[model samples]
Target: MTVTETTTAPAKIWDKAGGWQGVGTAVGILALTRVGQLLMIWWLGGATSEPRSVWDRLLVWDAGWFLRVAMDGYPHGYTYENGVLQGNELAFFPVYPMLIRFAAAIGFTPSTAAVLISWIASIGAAVALHLLGTSLYSKRAGWALVAICCSAPASVVLSMAYSESIFLALVAGMFVAAHRRAWWAAGLLGLLTALSRPTGAAAALGLGVAALIAVREIWKSENRIAWQPITAAAAALAGVPLYIGWVAWRVGDLDAWFKIQTAGWGTTFDYGSSTIKFLNTTLRTGDGWVSISIALMLLVALAAAGVALTQKPWLPLAVYGVVAMILVYGQAGFYHSKPRLLLPVLLTLLPAVVAASKARPRVAILSIVAWAAFGLWYGAYLVTVWPYTL
Candidate 1:
């Protein structure tokens, strides 16, 4: 049967045995990807340029700051003056750093804990992504989804000490659980997303919207939302207050979190016209394949989002993608980094995944393998070829 004729729920769930294979494949992918990333780091360490090398720069940039804060709890020290805000450390949000600090208290060093936690969360990310693909298309689609995500060059974030993997896992879980009508699970995950990343706003919004549509279907009425949807709405709302509260307590101001984002983090709105500006500059700036690839991918990702918006199962991904693009591209003074910023929203490409799954079984399997191989090599090459990033 063609994928469209089938409702996906039954045909998409793994045979009970496929679960084991999935886990094995996930482990293998994670190991090799992480090893490749680390090897690049080791290769860069001996270079005379030291931190100025591509590997050193990428490691030291935002990720390095996060690792430092994760290792040392923010003392809430230092005031902004003379670009000292850079050292004052007001640029980052508190959640992921808190996770690193808490994990370290139990036993793990900040860096070790960050990598370990991120690695584990990457698995969660893969599983949630699989379920999302299966929900929209088929079980075979889920396998393909997981394979691409696990190996995507951007998927390397899973091995890093960053919040993308953790946030994606939680955000993806929120949507997948909502699709299954698991109200409390969805609500809880939705709430956690709010706390995890600033982009949590987008995830929460997407989740609440998806849940409302779902609750309507479940109750066969539009007037009153079910408990799950209400819970999700509440969870999504909770982030604003939590953010405000933290800002108030730390900065002695109601809008400190967002204010710092604007004043300190360098994020601002360009309304996509600047996206054109960015595209032009990058193409003219003696750019290489990596820059061109990222610029093209960002545009393609936006188009795919239109396809995602039509279906309920994929709607959350669409909403998140649109919101993410605006937020990232709008504030993006640096156009070169869009790949890492937006790549975590892999579900935004669901239509493509679904279309690929429509192929005959042998072709589908081969397509998945090729995609994974590309991700592995491409991601490795990004770091290896440049050697000085951030």
Candidate 2:
């Protein structure tokens, strides 16, 4: 081979991997956001009467549930507390906890393993987000996407023993693979994404849309059908049902999973009635700043999703964003958790990232840093001072 070919081959591979510089920049931006947020958490924690260490704080709320799952495994039936059904480890997905269990088996404590897995997954998420953005837009947009997402409100979960980081990484990577028409990777990632969270159902549906689009284009142009996209879509679509079916079989009830969720967390699809009522009441008479802020954030997310539609993003992404928002808005659950749930709705952040990518470098950096300042602090405050489950 020629000397030019030898050098260019590695460059081509690196470019396909989002380029060394692009991925490095994205991870660097994520590191800064995480550090700033951790410091904020420490400061806020110190102000409390019973100060908790940052490490301890990261293992609070849902972290405990994940740890239980990692160490003890899921119960065979529903849990009851004081004769009332309660949410249990079954409500949590298995993949994150499974990884934690694996890590712990290698010698780390369960808590340490959980936190370590989440942090590692978050870094993977940064890389995936960068690749997705770079593929859809540009390197600047990729870096901006990583910066915006890692510092968004409730992004503290990325640093905690939570599954959001793993879910985000898989979902973002799945999207990137689908966009690039890598059927094998897309299918595997999609299946894994589905197993990570209930929201994976929406993600799988989005993958289906992408697959259909690819199939249609291929059929029109090549006069022959491509089976890979269809097969990938089928694999993706099966993930949610597969898990739900397992839960049902284990509990010997068809609706066991849904019942557990509803009983434990009051999580059920209410067709947005609960969301509407919450917003109406919060807007009219809610006195708490946190509640007010959450309500506002929900509204802003809806507006942003609408604006994103106007930008005509890739159809699959649009479908995922719309369905995911519907799921988030249409559910009856913890009111404060909406922002965290919305963090992976990359569509909502598209306009801002696109605009930032087009702006002067200094302007973009300043804008993102300003956003990170508030976003990171908001997340830290939620974990440190809000005194509730996120």
Candidate 3:
């Protein structure tokens, strides 16, 4: 598959699982993790070129493009700087910018509003993840999922002015809706998710697969058919194509978006050849810490995927995690970003954490501590020494 093709729940059981209190605890843990990261940044003198305050450092890298999009919509033509084409605003999705624009229009600077949007979305995502995990397994597993997410090496991106937090929250919401069999709600949330990130197609595919299995089971058990769920399945599958069609119409080419991604960012599909080359280069150099860190994260992802296969999480969640991982690893460009891209595969880690916790609570807690420590170090390294996109 090409770049466009490759890129890539549920709740309830309310009172029994501690409900909002569980969510609150999970968010609190994530917030504290963010605080630790902030302190690390402060101790490291921040990542800005001129030494600005830590609070002002959130708007770097892709955050700048998002802020520009919020402040001054998408440009009609491509942009270039010093003879090289720059990333276009059209490559970014609209939902996060729309929220930032709304927040800025009220009373905040675009920078402040963008950070606030990310922070709030991070908490919301924590809550949604808690609910989804609890509904799937035990309350312990739910808490474990939150702990793993908040401490993952890329979790710092959750607190930055990026769309990962919002995408995570919306995708978690879709999972809950699917679990509850609220087909329309799941479809609508999946649509919103697609509008937030290119990986949204993974969620749509997972939900559509789940809906099909549901319909099959119904057919096996009963003599009746349900149109609402079928409609929901169709709606869920439609979002990415709709957005791509809009892009095609705007640029007057069916593969305009893919070409833009390739030209602007060097992103394309090479069936893991790029990843293999990156790993080989890093190993041969013996100094590329960034490459080494990304490689370690990829190893962890493979382990998590193995755990998912062995543990057998809900079919939809399992499918979503696997597909998301494939998209992340299958991409050709930006090998350093593999860790950040894998952030959406939160479900893949759930089974591993839960199994560890169930078999040995002490070891699980120790692993969580180590994970958080690594995140703090890597997060700071990304800003301080590496100068790579997080």
**Best-fitting candidate, measured by lDDT?**
2
Looking at model 2, how many pairs of residues clash? 0
> Cα RMSD (Å) between model 3 and the true structure?
5.2
- For lDDT, candidate 1 versus 2, the one ahead is 2
How would you encode candidate 3's per-residue C-alpha lDDT over 1-390 as one tens digit per residue?
110110002224345443456777787778878898888877675545667567756777889989998999987656678977676988888899999999999999999999999999988788888877776765667777877877777777887898999998889878767776677788888888888888888888888876877676666667567565677767767777887778878877787778778887788877778887877777778666677768767876798788777766777878888888777777887877777788877765776667745867788778777878888767865765566676
Write the number of the candidate with greater lDDT, choosing between 1 and 3.
3
User: What lDDT does model 2 reach?
Assistant: 0.88
For all candidates, the clash counts are 7, 0, 5
Candidate 1 C-alpha lDDT tens digits along 1-390? 322332212122234432434555544555665675566545544453434443332343467667777776554634577755533344566667777788889998666777677778887887777666666566667766776666666666666667787887887777766666566777788787777776777777787777666666656644554675777768875874686577568767665665566665455676766678767866788477777777777777777766666644356666777776667777645565566777667645677677666788788767766766666656655554554442
- As for model 1, its CA RMSD to the true structure in angstroms is 4.3
C-alpha positional error of residue 76 in candidate 1 after TM-score superposition, expressed in Å? 3.2
Q: Is candidate 2 or candidate 3 better by lDDT?
A: 2
Q: How close is candidate 2 to the true structure, as a TM-score?
A: 0.95
TM-score for all predictions?
Answer: 0.82, 0.95, 0.91
Worst 10 residues of 3 by lDDT: 1-10
Q: For model 3, what is the alpha-carbon lDDT of residue 177?
A: 71
